[model samples]
Target: MRIFISSLISGFEQQRAAARRAVTALRHEAVMAEDFGAQPNSPQIACLRGLRESDMVVLILGEGYGFVPPGSTLSATHQEYREARETKPVLAFLQEGISPGPEQAAFIAEVQAWEGGLFRGTFRQPDDLQDGVTRALHDVTLANATGPVDERDMMTRALAMFAPENRNQVVPTMLELVVVGGPNQRILRPAEMEAPQLVEHLEQTALYGESRMFDRSLGVISGLDGSDLLLRQERGASIRLTEQGSIVVRLPLDEPRSARGFDPMSGMVLVEETVKERISIALAYVAAVLDRIDRTQRLTHLAIALRVAGADHRGWRTRAQHAANTNSIQMGHGGVQARDPINLLARRAALGLDRSALIEDLLVPLRRQYPTAN
Candidate 1:
């Protein structure tokens, strides 16, 4: 995430620097007016250009309204924010002690009213502003990766709910059942095998206990069903993917292309170009979450777990390296530990059968937000 820091260079310089460090600490690029040397264009033009390029904007309001470029009604800071809010999301922080001038206060009020812009509390210490920016960035990253309406987020939330010891079994089973054909295939679809037969197949593969697979598969079904990504044939006799599910699989909607080499009914395979594209997009989203592991360790852990499953399916080497760098998850023996961090965290949180609290904490909010999710 390239975060544009918009503020007056005079009074709020320290706060701006703090925000820059905070954003850099999270591994995101920070764009500030100070970083760019004197520009030939009007200062307003230069600032607005940077804001336009930014993924998100962070506005800091202090005692002064700052400069008003010739021929412009609003000050440079307010003008940059006004233009940025029109396109990108904005995060505004007002200083605590300094009373803004009338124009600045009015601009603050207008910013608070902007749709999609977030207004946070006033800041006194530089650390306060830093913390505010950090939290806001985390929320934005998480929301982008796993918001209520996001399909991948819904899938990840579901995967996090299963007991840690069983994730290896559960995730592979879900992937195999949902995705058909190709080198990365895991297991057969539910419709192809009866409950008894499915259990037998699991035993043959030595992947999971029949009973556990049965229980976990139901959970997967419920989550996907609620997300409208999966559908069961009359009376639950068989299961099939919804159109959204097809999208997950990277199956093309164009009839001729979809039918050319693969079975349209077979759904998305790892081989498709669309799957590659989705993996790329998903990696970018996961990167932001991974960057903030310091404050959001558990949620970041869950996010990596979800990504590892998808990465393994797609054979994404670069994605694996990125996760490993953050200590979120890894490859080889380290990878096993990465995937099963849930059980260890659970054990540390509590004893005996009550150890799922860690997972619950991360998932409960998502469940509430998406009440329809099982």
Candidate 2:
């Protein structure tokens, strides 16, 4: 139900206004769409964050004027489209005066390259945009809560398609399955085992969403647990995506940097840009994982050192050493010990997290480079 709305702050005031109204009308709980006068936060950074937490990214492609980085990707809308195409469905709400690529007859070659209706484009008038948004929400709402009756079976079918030769081809970069102790079965393995290259076992599952489920199913989320993970909900908080969806996630992987494609069986996720957009996605994920671990475990230690050394944003090593001398905890790439008072009580601790925010910046874009292995 939580959805994100994003549009060009510089060029499409009318379109952005319409979306703002539509979101209000539909009564979505969370709306993070903002207009930086079409020139906000270096354009790149702003748009990137706008698209991060969105369950469904509704972009306004009106006026066709906004800053977009060249070469790596084209057009803000196009970037959103391509990124959303592989991970989530991108809905292009064309303004009245908007133009299409070209006449079908003239672009026969271009048309052929398109595949299985990855994204959808729709046209709407100023008066009709609200109603249309409402209708779209109606469909999106049903989709988010309840999934198709055969969703599990479909995933089952997809799993069945896996073979021994493709083992590495389908391996998951991150594996999280709940190990339930039968009311009294002895608990052995700890929760969340990072990809253990040493372990050998068939980790396949018949579950739709997560391998290990926590509680009750709230609504009709048949699509998500299946091959379809992302959904557009007019009013919800967190969105769920499956490992398969992660395969389609984008990375900044392009020529110079690429995100290596993933296959659960293959167990490969690379962080090179340009090798393939898919690899970029992998790079983004790699960064996120590193960040999560660093933030949860490393940051705390580093912070301790940083504080003891006088919070001098500069000279991290010296500060770290001083902090290490104060606290006796390690810091840095190789982890060095710092003995100092990190002011650990300055902030309340979280479960390996301080707060929840977008893996924005390079994460999602890099995700674009990673490809879902065939």
Candidate 3:
């Protein structure tokens, strides 16, 4: 992949060299203004053209905002960044411990504010810049290799694996989360899945502690069918990891239960605090799982879907009410009830840097379904 390195060329010569070396080390072509000699078009025009042709942009910001050419309000680097952000992924790095000028500070703030496609990092030295750039480029390379996926179908099949035999049985309300990652070539070998270390790692990272998806038990059912690794709890929760790097976790949510017959008061109460905590724990576990797998196999991207089942009659309440009692807050007549699943696509970098943003992105729509309480 061709990566465009954008920054002020005057005082940032060493840093730019470092970034170029890092990009070339990964076997990716580095497009820099320094490399472009006499061109038919002006310098700014040539720089913009080069940035447009690149697959990704590595934006290095220092204390200076660089030269703003004639007939243009923005600097050359700024122009490249504006154009790159529209179409390509931008990996931004800011120099640490140095105060920036007003314009440069504003530019940095603007870049940081756009968290969707931008991944931000900080470096104190040339070597630090090189290392950060190399790692970022590697991640982008892996993301590019992850082919297209049918996320809806993937979620459907994953849910089927944990479906109950007796359809009439009233099961507890559950939150089913599915994450699919891969290069679409290979993920985990069957032998690797059964390794004692891998099982131990999963138990420690995902299945243990108070926030665990399943109950603490010695009975862990591990099986291999074709190219998938299946782990299940005796209760109801189950986890399926595919050779193509897909993970499906089905676990029950904490909700008020009906003792005997149909109780109108007994319905799904999604407390705001509890919902946020659970989602955070689940995301952290998934991130740990991916990191563990990344040691052996590279992952491109993650397709994450969060589905809440049996929530037809649901109530949204605050943490204070939930603490008082599960049934403290009665069913509300208002609030948009959501039956559809929440699907999200995240690059590998976003999982680490923009986790809070990811949580908000997933929960914002879900939260809107509930009305504000008095």
TM-score of 3: 0.65
Among the numbered candidates, top TM-score falls to 3
For candidate 2, lDDT tens digit of each residue in 79-98? 55456544444444545654
Off by over 4 Å in 2: 29-41, 63-65, 70-73, 97-121, 147-374
- The worst-scoring run of ten residues by lDDT in candidate 2 lies at 301-310
Rank the candidate models, highest lDDT first.
Answer: 3, 1, 2
| Window of ten residues with lowest summed lDDT in model 3 | 159-168
What are the models' TM-scores? 0.41, 0.34, 0.65
lDDT per residue (tens digit) for residues 6-117 in model 3: 9988888899999999999998899998889999999888989899889889999989888888888888888888898767778899999988889888898888876433
**Candidate 2 or 3, higher lDDT?**
3
Give the winner by lDDT. Answer: 3
Which clashing pairs does model 3 show?
Answer: none
Candidate 1 structure, TM-score to reference:
0.41
